[model samples]
Target chain A: MVGIVGYGAYIPRYRIKVDQIAGVWGADVQSYRKGLLVEEKSVPAPDQDTITMAVEASKRAIKRAGIDPREIGAVYVGSESHPYAVKPSGTVLAEAIGACPEVHTADLEFACKAGTEGMYLAMSLVKAGEIKYGLAVGADTSQGAPGDPLEYTTAAGAAAFIFGHDKILAEVVETYSYTTDTPDFWRREYQYYPRHGGRFTGDPAYFKHIIGAGRGIMAKAAIKPEDIKYVIFHQPNGKFPLRVGELLGFKKEQIEPGLLVTYLGNTYSGSSPLGLTATFDIAKPGDLILIVSFGSGAGSDAFLFRMTERIEEVKDLAPKTRETLEGPKVYVDYGTYAKFRKKIRKANE
Target chain B: MPTPARYWREIPQRYRLEAGRCRRCGFIAFPPRLICPGCRSREFEIIKLAEEGRVISYTIIRVPPHQFVDQAPYAVGIVELDDGVKLMGQIVDCPFEELRTGLRVRIEFRKIMEEGEAGIIYYGYKFVPA
Candidate 1:
């Protein structure tokens, strides 16, 4: 089965709490904390970006896979915050993980669901016997306009999966995608921050696509929600995944482990994939996992995975997603956040 | 200095930490020289360097370079890897007052500099207190 051989995730250590952002705007901190269900959000350091985070997570994925990087033939990175507008982050990530000199690399952008698009491609390449191994990464140093509500939840992080036919950690049972020409959120060319249609990002965008892909994949796999032991959805906020999970017939217990938006916030492209990584860390052999991702351009990708015995052997090979989230975090104030994000014009400018 | 071609050529060393080791005398070079400084070895083996190292020396730059004016008063240091190769880089995620000789550190990939507004971003290794 062409499935996940190994997986890894990275969440930056710097975090900014809701109160900090709320204080800057003189908004109601209690309402944002209660409404978003996000206490704090991960923030990338001044030196960290999409490429660097992708490399770090990819390295861990390679280690867990225990496959020679040279043997991998393809690498794909999905992100909205690629450091360079034109450069492919896949090349940098592949080189960093020692998969270079012979690799097909591409950078994908489909908003938050782009990472799963990379995963889908890798699965196809591996199952077709066209490549011995392939690596797919979803990562983003997500952007938020100053004083925007998005600033409270948009965060920085990455997740990577190595796909191969042998020693499978989770077998790919089925996959599906649901898409439309709905414009929920977008950032124009040369725009530093994104703009959203507020409430319009809700009904016709995130929910419709997510539910369509989830039900479609489940139907294709010939399984119901009760058959799956775990479920993870693209978490734009802590509330959305929980609400979506319930709407899709999943219990709260099934969504608990993968519900990381409470701690890490929305990692944009990394959202669902990072949730998947966290689930893989805690899932057992023979467990079934259902993952559905929603992107801002109004698309969703869903996959059904069945865990294999090999998962127990390699789950501990890399740092756990929870451990990274629980590691020592440096909290930044609004002034420091402005400096780190370069929101304030410098003397040179 | 931060041109696209120069950045492209340096990626293997800067991103992957790939170095050339002299097959003759076991000497390692960071920039991957053609001839080994030790034993004048003609043959070399490509190797990846260990991520962890020690801060051999450091300097706090208050009067910064043109591109680094915003991030001034930062600390830069020379680190000696376990393989005995020394490389110079910025010391980050640590307090300036805390930086000193013999501090244990680990290398991390980071943005080193940028040319100007809307310019190419240069990425390389930086040392963080382990």
Candidate 2:
């Protein structure tokens, strides 16, 4: 059976406080920071594109895997935030990593869950024996308009996974998915920040969809929430998962590994898969991991992974996910974030 | 020098630096191509960019394209212009060591390189910290 051999994650350095937003808007800071539980969120620099983030993550994944580039046969990128819509991000990634040129490749997009969603695809392709090995990358440098609430939360980061029929750290035991025309959040064309149903998304959208998907998979696999050692959910903010997880009987211990979004912010497409990689960093051999992803167009994917004997073997990866969180920041004020997100027009600077 | 036809493929950038903003997806292309990469739409409006920004990240070209070998050791950075557009160019008019990650820079048309060995010049935009 094919499974994940190596994993890596990347989060950008910048952070913005909701209080800063509150400061600019002259809104009440006590309410924003206290309620949001966000001191800052990340932002990607101008030079740092999704391509580079994937490349950076791939470098770590490759190093962790210790696989020769020539041995790989495929590459897949899943993102809602690709740099060039047509120029395959997978192709650029292959070049960036010096992967063998003849690799079978393509890019994938399924909104925010695309990263882990791509992993499921790669697992299928690799298990089919159509390819000996493969790589899947999910990355996004999400944008938010100046002084907007998202400006304090929309962030940047990436994660990559190497799938092969080799020393498996985690084997794909069972998988499930729930998708619908759930457009709880969306950004219209040429808009910097996305439009959400607001409180509507909080109730029947995020909490309902994420828990429904997670609970559905647990039932399908005949596993209770107690059977899984950890749970990784797509995080858009600090409270959503905690609230939903509790309603579903999961404590902080079960979701701690996936709580990265509070520090890194919403990575859009990279959110859930990144949480999975972080869980892998501490997971013991023989542990079981349950993963779920939610995106606003809206959809969710659930997967159950069983850590194998190789789990510890692959643990010595460069810049552990926690260390990588200690970023190399490109701290920008509201104006720069606006320009980075391209919400404002310059007269001729 | 006139932009080569090959370069005009991204007209808003090569000619006018007009980024194509997706009416549906809200993505902007720097070397404004006709299609929006974000949502694959054809609708857009011209917006002038602020030619000033900061060096979010950059690298020194110890090894560069064949055309820029003479300018090795120069800094090339991605600057976030005031208009929310990010542009890439060499950082000129300052000591390379002084060019910090968040340095403020303004864009100006300058000679990037010349193909005609020692006698000709080619001009393009380069960043100078304001």
Candidate 3:
């Protein structure tokens, strides 16, 4: 009964292509295209960031939920690139959505999985009757070091979910998390960009935790891979989600709908959650979905959900995820991208 | 650095597009006013301005203020919302050449200004192609 009452997603319209980036660093473009399976990635405008994207996505969610923003009793925003290190992103998010003054709010950080961490907390709080409605958002204006591999996919976007006991769209059936002391990726305090363990970030980090959490949630829900109509795994790149889906016994077709990294790139905390929103855009009632998110520290959070009839009513109330992904996009060259991302240091600085 | 109090005080209008509708004359005020200009009535109702609108006038800001130097060559426009409330805001995500009267747009939340590297980030509405 306690589940998603509404959901929404936001992706910045500006994009920087792989060739544009690869040309600057003299890296092979085909490798990034055929290897990583990422053609281009979204770029946030100078005015867009984690907080702004979260507020936009949350507004869409409030519309889909058809509930007064005042009804939201709690708000949680998960992101790695919060604008201010000291200020809480949730306060800004809650206030923009008109959920301020009476809502519990906080900002969460756990790499890419941070968004689902917020989702889990909000759902739990709603199920426990601690609040009438809870808002969970996963958003990021993720950063990549210049010339680093991460630059190909570190992108900007956000997804928001409202959890409540009534008018449930996706009923939460089971939740599970697999975490460890793995340190495959990290950013030190005062560091602008993150450092990763390279090949070590694989096998030992993303794959291990995702598979562990995926199987654990399926077992807890007493369902088989075939029983689920769709599955969304945290997509750091276009290749990982497909490879991991095959390893987890899911068909490519079942995973393809949520495989958004091909166009939108990796939105960090927004990855799996955005995938879920995209799936909801087309999923039929009674369809079962399994979502698993991976974070760099590292860990995975998995949840089993069943679509309800109400999904048909609210799915069309706001902009669909694919519309933004495939809609009008402004492609920027490397120089313009550098300027927009603040990669160039000014003489004044 | 500008006072954070000025930014904080505008949150309701800047963050939420809150407006005041004169209860007496039915006039909508962008930043809710204490007294209605139409009828001089103090009674007003809080309402949200419509998010979708059309461009009534526009200009390109090639030379900009210090806060927007990096974002120069941008477009600013006066949009008349569907609710008949007119307001001015920056028009984004559209090419300058394409901007014209009666172009459709919608309000989106965006960063308006940031004070240096370590100051308050001001957020508000900007117009984007609908």
Best by lDDT: 3
lDDT tens digits, residue span A1-349, model 1: 7799989898888999989999989999989888889999999988899998998898889889999999999999999988888878887788778888899999999989889999999999999999999999999988899999999999999999989999799999889999999989999998899999998998889888999999899888888899999999999888888888889999999999998999899998899999999999999999999899999888999989999999999999988999999887889998998888878885644
* All candidates: CA RMSD (Å): 1.7, 13.8, 0.9
Candidate 3 chain A: worst-modelled 10 consecutive residues by lDDT: A340-349
- The ten-residue window of minimal lDDT in model 1 chain A covers A340-349
lDDT of 1 at B122: 82
Off by over 4 Å in 2: A190-192, A327-330, B1-130
Q: Which stretches of candidate 1 lie over 4 Å from their true place?
A: A347-349, B97-102
Q: Over the stretch A160-239, how does candidate 3's per-residue lDDT look in tens digits?
A: 99999998999998999999989999999999999999999989999999999999998898899999999999999888
Which candidate number has the best DockQ?
A: 3
Sequence-dependent TM-score of model 1: 0.96
Measured against the true structure, the TM-scores of the candidates, in listed sequence, are: 0.96, 0.73, 0.99
Question: Residue A73 deviation, candidate 1, in Å?
Answer: 1.3
Superposed Cα deviation of residue B19, candidate 1 (Å): 1.7
Q: How many steric clashes between backbone atoms does each model show? A: 0, 12, 0
